[model samples]
Every structure is written in structure tokens, then in C-alpha cells.
Target: MSCNAASAAGPRIVSMNVCSDQLVLSLADPDQILGLSRCSRAAGQPGPAAKARTSPRLSGGAEDVLLLKPDLVVVSLFDKRATRDLLKAHGLSLVEFTVPRTLDEVKDQIRAMGDVLQHPQRAQADIARLDAAVAQVRAVASAHHYRVLPLERRGFVAGDSSLISSLLAATGLTNAAGELGLGAGGFASLEAIVQLRPDFILVSEAGNHAEDEGRAFLLHPALERFYPEGKRIVLPERLTVCGGVMLADALDRLTEELKRVTR
Candidate 1:
């Protein structure tokens, strides 16, 4: 259905992707949500996942979505194209969101989704909350100007153009990945990471525990030596993965983590 044709109270929506699930949960009225993706209810998940628990969940299948007879379906760029195609072919109105890499882009998405959901006032309120939270982080971050790197699983470093990098900037930290010559992000060699010696290594988790090979990179001997304990800041993956209402929490968490490490 076209945006003009959507109900003023908002369309009955089905979110087929985790990120979209969060957006819908945050922006849409509870009754407007027809169904949410199964991942939105995963154990220990953060952000809007909790709100998804009582809602109906889709199996990430076109048939399941079709059964709901939703007025609109939300997905992300990362979702399977065939599934999107199948839904579109069957005459479902769809909104596919791209991964946002900056605060401005994130706001644009919030506003866009708000427009689609017919909740412009709620979207503006969310944007205001997000701005206030970011300002709070920026206030503390502007003082120290630390050099930080968002070192992720499998040795990947988030570059200057990434959402993590944008968040780092908002928090008054420099993305060490830019210094290492990575623009959009890439795998940094162990030796290169060691040589850069950033003031702190921002990770999704702390401690020496490694859940898998990808996570093992964060626990590497070299990293441990350079960024032991207090030298690392853990932001939790859920906060950083997608841009939406959760970002307000993410920015607040960054500020707190920065304070913890800097102290």
C-alpha cells in the first residue's frame, strides 16, 4: 500500500527482520504490530527485543508473512532478496532499510520509518531523546579526546565511515582505524594493531572468554598485552549493531564505558 493510502492510525505491520522489529516496536503502537521476526525474541537479546516477546513472530518466511495479511512489511537490506521478492510479488507493501552509518542517516531513517508508520510525533520524540543522549556523551567525550578502535570479531576494525566510528566521534574518541588506513572498515593485522597502540580498544565484550574463533581475536595474546582489563571498553553488540531508538542507549553506554576506562 502507498504511504498516502496507509491508515492515519498506522498500517498493520509485520517486521520480517530483527532490526526492523526493533524499529516497529519502538515507533509503532502495540496494536499496529501484526507480527515480528523470531530473532527479536531471542534469549538475552537487548534493546526492543523484550517488547517483541508478547507479539506474534514470523518464521522469516513469505508464507508466514502472507498469512498475517499485513498492510505493510518491514525488512532490511541484509534480509534475503528472494524473500523480499516473493513478498513484493504477492502484492505486499514493503519497506527495506539500508544499514545506517552515521547519526544523521540514523535520524533520517527514524523519520522515514515514522512517516511510514504514521507516527510522526512519536518519531520526533524518539529523535529528541536520541539527540539528548548523544549530547550527554559528547559533553564528556569532548574533554579527553582519546584514540579508540572498535576492534571486532576476527580482527576486523570499524573504520571512520562506520556507525561505530560515528558513535566514537560523538563520544570524543578518534577511530584508530582511520590512522591504520581503513576507511569503511577491514581486517587489521595483529602486528598493525599492536603498532598503532590506541589508548583503548573498544570491543563488544570484555574478559578472556572466547565463544568462537571469531571472538578469539578479541582475546588474542597480543591484544591482551596491549589492552589489558581497564584499557578496553565493552559496549555490547546489541547497542551498536543497528541504528534506531536503541542508539540512545548505545550512546549513553559509550559515555559510561568511557568514564569507566578513563578513570
Candidate 2:
């Protein structure tokens, strides 16, 4: 379909990436979504699973999307190259988004999708709420200055270049990862993490048991003893994995978790 057709009553959209899936699901009308990526409903997929389940999950095929004749297809720069080429070959109108690294970029993305989905007001509303959430967190953070490390399995650290770091700074908390000289992000050794002595490590989950080598690393005996439940923050991967309206919820939870843990 020609791009001009999307100007009418919210385009029929197919999201080919999980991040964009979250954005589309957040801002689009139910009928406006034509399909979602196959991984859109995978474990830890952000946003509303019910809305995602209501649509067909694409199996990395562009032909089916062509048949659907969606007014727009959203993809990321990192999406499969062959599939992107195939969709381009068919001249399907497409919008591309890059992974956002800062809070402002996240807001821009939400605003962009808002226009794409014909729901600018909803996007603005979500942005306002996100701003309010940030304000709340800032209030709490101003009274407390602690370093938080957004740690992941295998000691992966979310560093200064990530959206999480931006959120941390915006709310008055510090990302301990930046202190380790990891600007974009990198892995940390157990010894390094212990030496850093962060006030808290932000984990995606609060698993006390290990299910695999990666999970095992996080639950290493030493970690369990040092960064136990009360010492670690449990912000689900779904909430922090991608930056979108979910960040509003993330910010709110950060507020509550900070209040609970510091008290």
C-alpha cells in the first residue's frame, strides 16, 4: 500500500521486531494492528501479551505480510537482513526504529509511533505519565544517593549507553556500571562486582535457583549471599527489556522498590 493511505484512520500495522511490537501494541488501536513478530509473545516480551496474542505472529516471512496489505510495517535496523530486503522488494511501506539509548529517544519513539498509529493524544498522555513517574522517582532519589548496577545473567552489565542508565540518571540514582569504566556495557567478573560495592544490583528477576549456566552464574553461591532479595532489585525483564510506555511502569516500580528496600 502507498504510504499516503496510512493517513486515514490509523494504518493496519505489522511489527517485525519485539521492541517495535511493544510500541505498536502500546499506541495502536486493536484493529489497526495487522500482525506481530513471532517472538512478540515470547517469554519476557514487554507490554500487553493479551493484545499481542490477539494478532497473528509472523514467522519471519515477508510474503504473508505482503498478502495482508498492511498500510505500514515496522522493523528495526537489526531485523533479519533478508526479510527486510524482501519486504523492500515488494515496496511495502515501512518504518524503521533503532534501539533507543536515552529517555528522550524513548519519548521520541513513542511519539513517532503515536503519529504512525494515529493516536498522538494517547502517546502524549503516556509521555506525561512517564514524566510524572520520573518526577516521583526523582523526589525519592534526591533524598537518597545510591549506586545501582543493572546486572544480568553471566555478569552482563547495562552501562552508561543503555536506556536503563539514562533512566537511572534522570531519577537521581547512579549506574554503578559506569563506575567500572563500561560505557556502552560489558560483562563483569564476580570479583569486580564485589569490589565495586554498589548499594544494589538491579536484576531482571529474583530467582534464587539456577536453571542453566547463565542463570547459574547469577545465583553463584557468592552472589546469593551478598546480593540477596533485599539487596537486589527485581525489575522484570519485560519492563526494562525495551523502552516504551512500559517505562512509565518501570519508573513507578523503581519508586516503590526503592522505598521498600531503603526502608
Each model's C-alpha lDDT? 0.86, 0.88
- What's the alpha carbon RMSD for model 1? 2.2
Residue pairs whose backbone atoms clash in candidate 1: none
Weakest 10 consecutive residues of candidate 2 by summed lDDT: 1-10
Q: Model 1 scores what on Cα lDDT?
A: 0.86
Instruction: Give me the candidate number with maximum lDDT.
Output: 2
C-alpha RMSD in Å of predicted model 2 compared with the true structure: 1.8
- State TM-scores per candidate: 0.93, 0.93
Model 1: per-residue Cα lDDT at residue 195: 94
Model 1 regions lying over 4 Å from their true place: 1-8
The per-prediction tally of clashing pairs is 0, 0
Instruction: Report the error of model 1 at residue 65, Å.
Output: 1.4
Tell me model 2's lDDT, rounded to 2 decimals: 0.88
